[model samples]
Structures are given as structure tokens and as C-alpha cells.
Target: MDGKTLVRRTNFTRIIAACAFIFATAASAGPTVKTLRVDVLYWSMNIPGQVAMRKGLEQEAAAINRDADKKNQPRIELTPYIAGDGSAGIERQIAQMFEAVKRKPDIIIVQPTDNAALAAPLRAANQAGIPVVAYDQYISGGTLAAFVTSDNYQAGYLDGEYLAAHFPDSKELKLILVEYPHVSSTVERANGLLDALRDYRQPFRILKTYEAVEPNSGARAGAQMLRDFPATGSVDAVFSVNDGGGLNIVEALANAGRTEIVVASIDGDPKSVDNIRAKRLTHIDAAQFCGPLGAEAMKIAYALATGKKVAPHHLVPVFPITSETLQLYPGWGGPIPPRFAKPWQARVPYWEGTVRPAK
Candidate 1:
């Protein structure tokens, strides 16, 4: 062969070898590791259910980061902001959400403080292409990627049903309410309780409605209720929207030696359950799977981040803890309890919340 031809062939061989080397390098390089920064904004930290929920989010996020293969999915970085611990906490939550929007996180998971206040900021986030997951409470005006919360209405209904069953013989049961109407969950509970009483064919007069869903206000409400209905047979029962305030109200009533007024409340708080066991004023408490609610919110966010389709709403079932059903409860950190016992069965499946698309 000619020398020039031999040199051309050698150069061609070198080019082929270079192409093979490039291909091998590209093949060995794995998928990029991604990080999803999540901003979690909640109304208050003083509540047990809220605290348990945040813990659940952290736990589930950690598990997602560790269990997921790095090459396949993204790691989660959670940033949490809590509103101040008082009635004025809603104002702080509004400010924090504005800040969260400014920061432009991959996602925002929030438990709204005031139902209608977040409408504007949430809409702003949507306009900016950021997705949101809401749990425990509904924020009124904005479109959400997903929402997860306890079946609050059913919880209240169950509490009301329990109260109605106890006072079966009375033609008209007189009840007072310890309620906070600021958020959808609490409001739903109040409505549920009233509806249950109505459905049971047990007529009731809402003798008084006092506003409070926490300890201090609850105690005040309880004290006032006692004074208002000073007579022994004036008030037959009281329904508290949550155990946070309900428990305190019961203490006040019990201390005042007003044991005749039976109480029904929501939130499967340990103290409330103990009250039931000790036969205190709290006869039936509707328990939320608080931890699972938070975990479900995180799981929904993760699904959205990874391009997986998810339902727009998720509803977790609540458990009713009377002294009879207390043994089935696994407390705030575990997943929701399965179907057990009649009449207290789920209103909707644990995974069955769906918000239909607009026409």
C-alpha cells in the first residue's frame, strides 16, 4: 500500500476509537440528582394535631429521600414556617405565605389559618406556576394541586350522634356550643354535630354558641355556659368543636360540679381519651389521623414533582374514641386506622377525595 493511504487508514481507525470512547463515557454517566425545595406554612404550632402533622411530614420526607434511588427520583428539602401561637396567628400566616411566594419554592404545603384570607396569595402562586398542597384546613380562594384533611363533618356527626344516644328520652335536648368558625374544618364539625342531632330525630335547641377552639377561650366559654344555664336541668349537653378547647371546657364544668351536662368533642387527644376512661364530661371524641394527614400531603407533593398524576383532593378518615373503641387507636403518629365497628364506618375511603375539573 502507498504511505499516504496507510496514514489515512490509521487516522480513520483513531477516529473510530475516539467515537467508541465518547459513547462509553456517556453510557456510564447516570441520571442527574435533583433536589426539590419545599416550603411548609402552617397557622399554629401550639395544637397537638398540628405538631404531630409536621412531625409526620418530616418523617415521610426523610423516608422519601433515603428510600428513593438517587438516580431515579429527587431528594426533598423541607422548610417550615409557623404562625404565632394565638388567635392572631392567622395574620402571621398571611405574611408568611407572601414570603413563601416570593422565595419561589418547588412546592408549598400549607395548613391555612383563615379560610378566606389566603385566596389572593395562593392565586398569585398559581399564576407563577407553583403548586400547593393543603391539609387540615381549606384555604378558600385559590386552586390547589391537592388537599388532605380529616373527614371533619363526619367527626362532628359522630360526636353529635353519641350525645343524642345518651339523651334518648328527652323530647328537646338543650345544648351549648364551644365553636370556632374561622376555619372550614371547625365549621364543618359544628354543622355535622347539629345535623346528626337533627337526623337522629332528636330535636335540640342551641341554647348558646360561644366562640373558642383552644384552652383559654374554651375555659371562658365553659364558665359562661355554667352561669347562663345555672339551673340543673337548663342545659342537657354541650358539643365542643375540638378537644383542644373541649378538654378545658370539660375540666371547668367538672370542677364547677356540673357533671350533669354531658360533653362531646373532636380530636382524639390523649387527655380527652383519658377523660372518657375516667368517665369525665367528654364521652365521645372524634380522632383524626393527624400524622397520616401530613404524610399524605407530602406524598402528593412528591408525586407532582416527579411528573406523576395525583388526585386534586385527599380525605383521611377520623376515628371515634369512646371508652368502647379506645383500644383501636394508634395515636397521632401512625397511619389511619382501618374500618372497624359499625355506625362509625368511613364516610369516604381514605384515598377517595377527588375534585372534578371545570366544565
Candidate 2:
């Protein structure tokens, strides 16, 4: 061959050999995992369930990143947006979803504030091919890759069942629901509570439904509840959806020097458990496996991001923490206690259970 032609051939051979060496090195290093970008649209962190879910998600993410270096696992980049507190938060959540869609994240994980309000933005996210994984509360109008949440109905059922067993069947038990109806989780809670009362054939009448699910609103509702039922024995029981605002009601009743009302609530908040232990107004508190609920949500999101098939819905079990079952719970970041009670007849499926909480 001529000198210039021979030089060109030599360089081409070297290029092929270098590519082979690179491939061999990569093969020895094991499989490559693609990192995913996830945006989190969280409702108010004021609620204890959201706080625990956040903690659990962070812990699980850290674990995944730590393991990524050693195992064939993907790492995730998380961007968070928090909606402000109370009913005002519902608007903020709706706006945040549209903004999240603009950013074009690999996955959008959300705790929806209002089921119907989110339909527009969530539907937009769907059209864009950005998968979403929702937790705690559901989004109404989208094809969610996965949805993970505690068995909200079961929590309310536990509260209602507890009240049914204790209250006198002779008179209709005066009932109050410290409720917010926009979100599916709380709505299910109220439904479950009422279902339990009916299932047990307990006589009861709903005195009122005070709109409150956070601290400030709860405080107002609590004080108002007392005004409406001035006498000590006027209100038989109160069932607050979650402890975020429910604790405010508890404190309000306590501060007013009232003791006649028997209060039951959903959520496994530390303070709620404390109230139960102290023999206070919040007699029974049904608790969520909050930390684990968050962690499992992360796992589901990760699976979807990595192009793995995940179950569309996963429901974690909730525990009822009374004075007796308090010992079974080890707090939020937990060695989640085994399923404690017999099966509950709920509207939701029997697949209610949780994974280990991220420590």
C-alpha cells in the first residue's frame, strides 16, 4: 500500500481496538443504570401524615442512592414543591402541578389536595407522557403509574367500631366529623367511620360536619363545636379525619374544661397517641404506617421511572392506637408491627399492608 493509505488503515484499526477495550471494561463493571428525575408536589407539611411520608421518602431515596454505587440500581434527582396550608392549599396544589408539568420531570409524585381540581393538570401530564405516582391522596383525571396510600377507610372504620362498642345503644350517639371533603383520603375516612357505626348497629346522629383538617381551622371548629353543644353531655362523640387538625379540637375541648365528649380520630400521630395514653378526649387514634407508606411510594415511583411494571394501587394497613395497642407501635420510623386486629370489612380491598419504614 502507499504511505498515506497505510497510515489511514493503521489509525482505523486502532480506533476499533480502543472501542473493544472500552466495551470490555464496561462489561467487567456490570450493567449501567440510568438516573431518573422526579418532581414532588406535596400538600401542606402541616399534617403529620405528610410529614412522615416526606421523612420516609427522603430516607428511601438516600438508601437507593447509597446502594446505586454498589448495586445495579438507579439514582434519583428529587425536586420538591410544597403547597401552603389549609383550604387555600388546594389552589396552590393545582397551580404546582401545571408548573411541574412545565419542568417535564421523568416522574411527578404528588399528595393531591383536591381530587377533582387536579384533573386538568394531571390530564395534561398524562398527554405529555410524564408518568405520575400519587400517594396519601389520589389525583382524579390521570392514568397514574402507581398510587400508594394507607388504608384510609379502615382507619375510620376502626375509630367508628371502637366508638360503637363503648357507647350506649339505647340513645342515638351524638356525632361530629371534623372533616374536609375535597380529598379522597379524608372522604373515605368519614365514610369508613359511618360504615362502622352502621355495621355494628349503633344508634347515632350526625350533629354537624365542621370543615377543618389542619391546626388553625381545627381550632376554630373545636371552639365552635363547644358553643353549639354547650352542655357537657350534649355531644356524644367526635371523629376527626386526621390528627393535623384533630389535635387542635382535642386541645380546644380540653381547654374549655370539658370531659363528656368521647373523641376518636384517624392518623397515628405521636401527639394523638399521647392523648390516648393521658386518658384525654381523643380516646382512640387509628394510626397509619406513615413512614413505611412514604417509603413504599418511593419504591413504586422508582420502579416506574426505571421502566419496570408496578401495581397501579398499593394500600398500606393502618393501626388503631388505643391504650391497649399502644405498646405494639414503635413510632413512625418503625419495625412495622404485624397486622394486629382481625380483618375489617371495608369498601377497599383486603390487600392492605406496609413495607418496612426507611430508618
Candidate 3:
């Protein structure tokens, strides 16, 4: 070959090699690594939020792990600390969060006992540059990095509206409000229902209100209420703040041969949906977005860990489900919508699944 041709070929090969090297370097230089720790404070793993986390809907940790695999980000490790139930247990959760703060977790997930219990610790965490994200129930008026939850008050108001619509002609409406102690969600819901009912202006009497120590305690409370007010005639409606509690009320009413009483509650779980199908339960203020709530919680945690700005609160919407519409879709009891079938998709599937049946 001629010397000039050889030189030109060598230059071309060198240029190709340099380009490949630059491309390789750029590919290797991916996103930065960020280490974040998350703690989940909740009553039971069996509930919807915990269940979503367990089922992997939040995907914060998973997203971090994926980014790590792609050489783009750091690994996020989540540690869950479960508090059994009620005010005392939630107090213990606050103690655990204080201890976690010392370890310096980038973010912590809390279900506050009330508006006050976790205020100090959260403030301390914020002052120390750690972000706090609360879920299910929020600790209001604090430096909470983000509050992820459904519109609980609206859910309760919807329940009240449903009851009012169902019993429009009643002159004197007798009802029982069943709730659980230290459950901020329940408290807000019950209060919202009472607030909505105030517009009725009828001779409605709240015969009594009862507190259930556990979710299942609603049955006992309902039965006792029935026995106590049997002579006063039948209850027009029973408003339970949660599905489990509502189911308990239904069971109690059934056992007492008072199936005619309308039952309503929030959270459309499998049993509650079944009860609706069977005509035992009348209404449910459904918050089928627990998965999204978990996802939002993790997203806020990730943002805080990475030193990104996040909102102080996030209010997810809630919907009402009645006996007329509860079973249009499958796996309202299981995770993932019916469309995905084998594996779960993203928020689209969740919204579609929850809304399709209702529509």
C-alpha cells in the first residue's frame, strides 16, 4: 500500500478508538449513589398500606436498587418498625423514631399517634437535617417533609351523605358511631361524618358512640349497643370508621336478627366488598389508593435523602362505593388489577382497577 493511504487508514482507526473510549467513559459515569434508610411505623402488616409495601408497590427501594444496578444512584435500605395498636403503641413508635434519628436515617415514615405525640421528634429530625414523611395519619402543623394519606375527612363525609340519602324519610334517625382508640384516621372520619350530618336538621339522635380497642372489637361494641338500645327500636344506620369495624357491626347486627339496619364504613376490603355484595353492608368510602400512598411516601423519602425539596403534605383522593357497585372487577381483595393478571403494572392499573368496577 502507498504511505499516504496507510497514514489515512491509521488516522481513521485512531479516531474510531478515541470515540469508543469516550462513549465507554460516558456510559460508565452514571447517576450518583445515595444511601437512605426508611422506617415504617404502622399498626398491622395485614392492613392495606402495610400490605402494599410488603407487596412492593411503593418501589422507592426498588427504584434505588435499579438505579444502583445501572450505575446511576446509591442503594436505599428500608427498615420497618411495627407498633402493635392504640395510643401507647404509637408512643412507642415515637421513641423508636428518636432512636432512629441518632443513626441518622435520611428519612423516616411515621403514623403519628395524634397531632402532638411526634411533633417534637419530627422537629428535632428536621433541625438535624433529616426529613420526616408521615403516612396514613399526619402530625399537623409541623415541619413534616411530606404527609402522604387519603382525604380521610371526605371519606367520612361521603359515608354520612350515603346514610342520609338512604334514610331520607326517617323522622328520627338513630345511629351508632363505632371507632377505634388512637386511630387518627378513624377519629378524623368520625368527626367528618358528624360534621356532614349537622346539615340534616332532622330529629336525629346519636344514641351512643363506642370505642373498640382492636379492629375486631367493633362486633362486641355493636352487640352491646344493640342490647342497650333494643327497646328504642331499630337503628337506622351504623357508621363504622373502618371496614374491619364495619364488618364487625354487620356481624353483630346479623347475630342479633337486626339485618335491616344499614351498615356503612370506610376502606373497601375484600370482606367489606363481600358484605356489600350480600346486602349486609350498605356503603363504603373506598380508599383504594393505599399503594399510591406507599409509593408517595417512598418518593418523598428518596427526595429528602437526595437533598431534594419536597412538599409538606400530599392528600390523595378517596371515593365512595355502595351496594350497587362493588363487584365489577376481580381481585379487589388481592393486589394488582385484573387487567395485569399475572404481574402488577403501575398507577394506571391501580386507578383503572379501582374505577372500572365502580363505573
TM-score of each: 0.87, 0.88, 0.77
lDDT (C-alpha, whole model) for all candidates: 0.82, 0.84, 0.65
Counted clashes in each candidate structure: 0, 1, 3
Give the per-residue lDDT digits (tens) of candidate 1, residues 1-359: 99999999999999999999988887787656778989999766777878888888888999899877654678988888998656568778888888999999999999998889889889989998899888888889979998888889878988877776777645788888888888999999999998888877788888889988777787888788778878887888888898777877898888988888788888888888889899887788888878887888899899988888987776777877888777777887765556665433333313222222212
The order by descending TM-score is 2, 1, 3
Determine which window of 10 residues in candidate 3 has minimal summed lDDT: 340-349
lDDT of 3: 0.65
96-163, model 2: which lDDT tens digit per residue? 99999999999999988888888999899999999998898888876887888888887888888888
Worst 10 residues of 1 by lDDT: 349-358
RMSD of 3: 8.6
lDDT comparing candidate 1 with the true structure: 0.82
Error of 1 at 175 (Å): 0.4
23-120: candidate 3 lDDT, tens digit per residue:
89977875445566666665465355446544443465687678767865667777777665566667787788788788787677776656667777
Candidate 1 matches the true fold with a TM-score of 0.87
